[model samples]
Target: MLMKANEPVGSGQTGLSDSEAASLYRLMTWLSPSFPVGAFSYSSGIEWAVEAGDIVDATSLRHWLASMLADGAGLCDGIFLAQTHRAASSGDDVLLAEVAELASAFATSRERHLETTAQGRAFIEIARAAWNSPPLDRLIAVCEVAIVYPVAVGLVSAAHATPLAPTVHAFLHAVVSNWISAGARLVPLGQTDSQRLLVELEPVVSATATRALKASLDDLGSATFRADLASMRHEAQYTRLFRS
Candidate 1:
């Protein structure tokens, strides 16, 4: 998995000189829900789905999550993360700003925008203060306007010189894990069942990451209208547990 520092952007290389253990640890730490991004408070619309009976059981939950990874915000965010990494790696602050702006405006609704921006703001603040890095700082300076969560993460990973494929995979995995956690609480799923569902989605996660790794921003699109509508509806959800 080792790749040279000079490899093409998004080449998915684990740099030859990069410490594999350190890279893994950094990815784990940043992606953990405990990272203070407040990821636990948002459901990414999963709460609305579960309440609407769209995701009632493990099977339904897996199906919904797969859809999200394949054709929804998951795909969009992966592109932002990958593109931002490449731009930040080359110190192209211009491109970084563009990606960040696009990600911010790409949100389909108020809840969706809040979900990305709030978490994004929190991520940059924490990463800058605690896990400071040159690349991360450059990203911040470049995107003076705003920094989306995926873009912030991409900047950090690229600064650390981590491989793109693994970074994106870990990012998406954390996302899915967070959503699963939400599902477990909202649906009151058993711990064993939650783990089982996660296991079942591993293949989907890998495939989504691979697809996003190879995808260009031109490929950005989503067919998950239900999810989008659910998020919009969540804004008015009479009794909701998640923020989005």
Candidate 2:
């Protein structure tokens, strides 16, 4: 069953079990900035937003990221992750392949496509080396095409038996955190402001994950036109610090 927005994940009436704890550990490790998916190298167009003066201060930064989480890539990626997790958990290879194809085709820009697929490939290769499993291997075989970021994460998490709620939550959190990191540098905000932004985004992340868990594939769409435009404009940005 899907977890509620406010429910504790990886815990029961007895609290966290060893297996649950292990799953949490794996999630943390895989989603960590240091996990080597090259997440730090991409700002998801936050750099362009900063350059365009769309995110000039903490308030603007918060609003921009909130929109992204609620209406843009953050929400879309969460839905893909949820769908992929469900398909993998059910051993539905057809559904899994379909999700993979849709996700790969979902990118709004060229750099966006590169950002997701490059990270997805790196994630699968690293996970296979460190956390190999039959399901993970099977996912690689069935998908065949270049996997997108969210699908790769969902597949790996399911292969290791991590629950869907926490996996989706962590994935969104990591994405938001990466964006904040970019803003911190581009906006030249202090560490406190960056941390404060992260704290403020917690509710958005939780709500996004919950919505994604309930979303159907037909619901997949992005309304953040400015954000998409930002991504496209970033490609032509002469002074760029991020890959996307």
- Cα lDDT tens digits, model 1, 73-162, are 888899999998998888787888888888888998899889988988898888788877765675677886667789878988888888
Summarize candidate 2's per-residue lDDT along 118-214 as a digit string, tens digits.
9999999999999989878987788967999999999999999999999999999999999999889999899999999999999999999999999
> What C-alpha lDDT do the candidate models reach, one value each?
0.87, 0.93
Model 1: per-residue Cα lDDT at residue 227: 94
Runs in model 2 deviating more than 4 A are 1-14
- State the weakest 10-residue window (summed lDDT) of model 2: 7-16
Which residue pairs in candidate 2 collide? none
> What TM-score against the true fold does each predicted structure earn?
0.90, 0.93
User: Which regions of candidate 1 are displaced past 4 Å?
Assistant: 1-18
